[model samples]
Target: MQPSKLRKRIGGEDDDGRHARFLQIGVPRGVLRCRRGPMDSANDSVEKKHRKVLSDLAWAMHKLPPKTYSLSVEDGAQDAFCDWAEAYWEKADQPTTKPLLAALYNKLPDHATKLSGTLHLVNEYDPDNSDQWHPSKTIPLSVIRLALAIIDCLVVEAERFHANTDDLEAQAIARFKELPPVEWTWDKFKAKCKDPIRKEGSKLWTNVVTAMRDAGIGEVTKSKPLTFRRHTDVDGHRKMSA
Candidate 1:
């Protein structure tokens, strides 16, 4: 169910300088509703809820087609970031040990401003050099909530990969869709299309392939003409061959 691995074909080949372009999507807040459960302790319940929402979001991204979006480096870094953030806060003796990201989904603050306030402390977070977070810790909302500083990093980095990705794709697909139908093997389609399809934007091949797939262009198979032959045998009986 975890689809982060599913990005391999489209977003996986990050080795040769071709990194994934993280697509920016606004997940509906309604979709993020928490699944209710019994709480063991104070902050433990908060973390449990947050973790569930994270899982749902990850699943949503996974259920999308391989061509739907590209992976960002920040996609899977949530846990480490939270732990590291908490470790940093620990030394400072902040009123609460629970990272802001550890907040319940409904209570989780704005993604931007809350993160900006504490990012300067990320370097100080080394678990080997610091104490770790425990599941049973009690954190009340009354304390100053200095949250998951790294998720701010994720959302911030998330901003980088989406420079007109959607617009460019819509344009490319619109252009390709207008072309006259032809014998549309991939190579043939490329030869017929220009720029985005032919050369310019080949780095995102899925977009190009998607255009063709959705546009419904391809060669149709035709039946060959049937032929029959007759030969006389020595017994004077005729037999037909196809």
Candidate 2:
């Protein structure tokens, strides 16, 4: 469960543009209007680029050995330089080799100030250039940290899914208990309720169904009336569906 690629559907053609119109007054400028206050965060084209980089990083992490994975680009470049020096420098004199080595070593960028430059140097040394020479652009530490945190969250969720499906079922039961007894569909429930469970976004239906099954609520049969029910005693042991 590496986070399901569940997409949400918007009703009309303006569905995609609706969010943009809400957050911005103009098209080209994309100026932040903040009609809905601080929650109306602005979206920019750079967000896609950042997402791609993080996806690449996560993919690379999956393939490589954890102990060998180096977040610091400079470290990888230094290792490459050492290997190159060992192989290429055969009969070079100490004076010539010393300066050559020093020059190569100095080329590694200062990590604290120039992370982008460090990544550039690493790209040059990498035969595969897996980052595709695009790391030259300065990416903020905040973005990188946020990406890592998301990855960590997904990995943890995956582990939990395997280990504690029962726990999730219990949680769903508990959440259902908090709400008034009602037949509910995810869409209707989310619109009417401000409960944290309903705000699960794209995976709301999946989660609700999973919890329903785990709690032995009922089977999901597809028909004209699409509904899920809470088996509560509120209406005298009667099942409620929505």
Candidate 3:
């Protein structure tokens, strides 16, 4: 049976859930039995062996959260994976041309680095710009990885949805539009958090913002300002002048 079909039959959450059960069942016994000819059964056995090996490899990589383990961007390994994918496409000799992949591989890192530097430069000149501008350098490697995974998921999903290149590009633009505005200063970001519009129901955006804040992209203020007002006594009453 296909992995998906097996999961459905076992009434699990997803393929990973089913695989977890398979692991518990023990590797040797978890080997899939096929109701087919000897040759087919042998092939199935070989495939099962490889699958078990992969499962062991995944376990050795550390116990990641379901989100991370999921074949999705929430895993936070998207950026590195994207780098690997670009290299894979360059090396792999598939029948179809991968010009788009080539273009992305060439453009993304340079674009990210340039945009990050520009935002940093602008921050030094104008505090206002610094508040709303998030440079790409502030993005964590894990988060970038997750973002890349999400991108991959969207592409695969688009193919499943019978979407064309234009549709895919449009979707990418839409996703980018949804990302939170970048802020170079913590104080500026804190001000943003106080804005009624920003504080509204955006959990993921809030989390990313918080992560950036934690990473020192946005630092919290520590000390109160000292007052230097002059105090004058008039008719036995002390009055403070700003």
Candidate 4:
């Protein structure tokens, strides 16, 4: 059967990926357009261009393919991405709402993935076992390259199904890769990323606050305490863990 058309929804009720979420796979603005309302409507407002830029990053999270990037992503993963895009956009504070232009800018600089610089972007596998898993900040570039390759492959698959009817995942990928207006670069991956990358954190926080506020007079909110983890560091490697 033909791949099902990517569904397009609008207006997330402060829930996970809701509005326009189904189109998130690789459609432009699908991932970045999570913040609701006209002001956030397009993230193109003047005020939207005045936030901060995070200097470093560290990320770790496990995603079961079907759960991480597919239909149910809105249930969790999509919200996670939306949070990052929104948060990063505020920091990027640029006229456009796309966070990837800022988030991945440094990602492809010359020799960037090489062994240099104290600030590092590292990804670890088996994050639960100390012998097999734990956040590692100083892994060698050779190791990183392999990991990155795997990630690249996964990402390609992750967004493939979001391709248009006339487009196979490969065709879509190739077409989007060379989109005119300019040559492809880490900075201009905006087209390929399809939409603004979601801000990092807030969706869950917003839910919690909402729950607390809704409790009204004597809100007896009971849930795990929100824990804080720092993923950014100036003096050493900045890691990203989801």
lDDT of 1 by residue, 66-178 (tens): 33111122433344434454553453355542222122121223342234322322322333332341111222221113344444445434343333344455555555455
Ranking by lDDT: 2, 1, 3, 4
Per-model CA lDDT versus the true structure:
0.37, 0.42, 0.37, 0.32
Candidate 1 lDDT for residue 155: 40
Give the distance in Å from residue 174's predicted Cα in candidate 2 to where it truly belongs: 3.8
The digit string of per-residue lDDT tens for model 2 on 1-242 reads: 11121111212123233321221111121235845645422454577666776676656534543232233443354444334334333423345443322332233222112443333333433335664533333333443343434433443443333233334434555665566656666566556544554445535456556546554665445433445665554422335598
Model 3 alpha-carbon drift over 4 Å, by segment: 1-82, 91-93, 96-136, 162-242
Please state the error at residue 228 of candidate 4 in Å: 59
| lDDT (10s digit) by residue, model 3, range 131-223 | 343333243444444445544554444232221322333332233223353322333333434343333324323333333333333332332
Cα RMSD for candidates in order: 21.5, 20.9, 28.8, 26.1
Candidate 3 local accuracy as lDDT? 0.37
Q: Which scores better on lDDT, 1 or 2? A: 2
RMSD of model 1 against the true structure? 21.5
Instruction: Name the runs in model 4 displaced over 4 angstroms.
Output: 1-137, 166-242
Write down the TM-score of every candidate: 0.27, 0.27, 0.21, 0.20
The backbone clash count of each candidate, in order, is 2, 0, 8, 33
Please, what's the RMSD in Å of model 3? 28.8
Top candidate by lDDT: 2
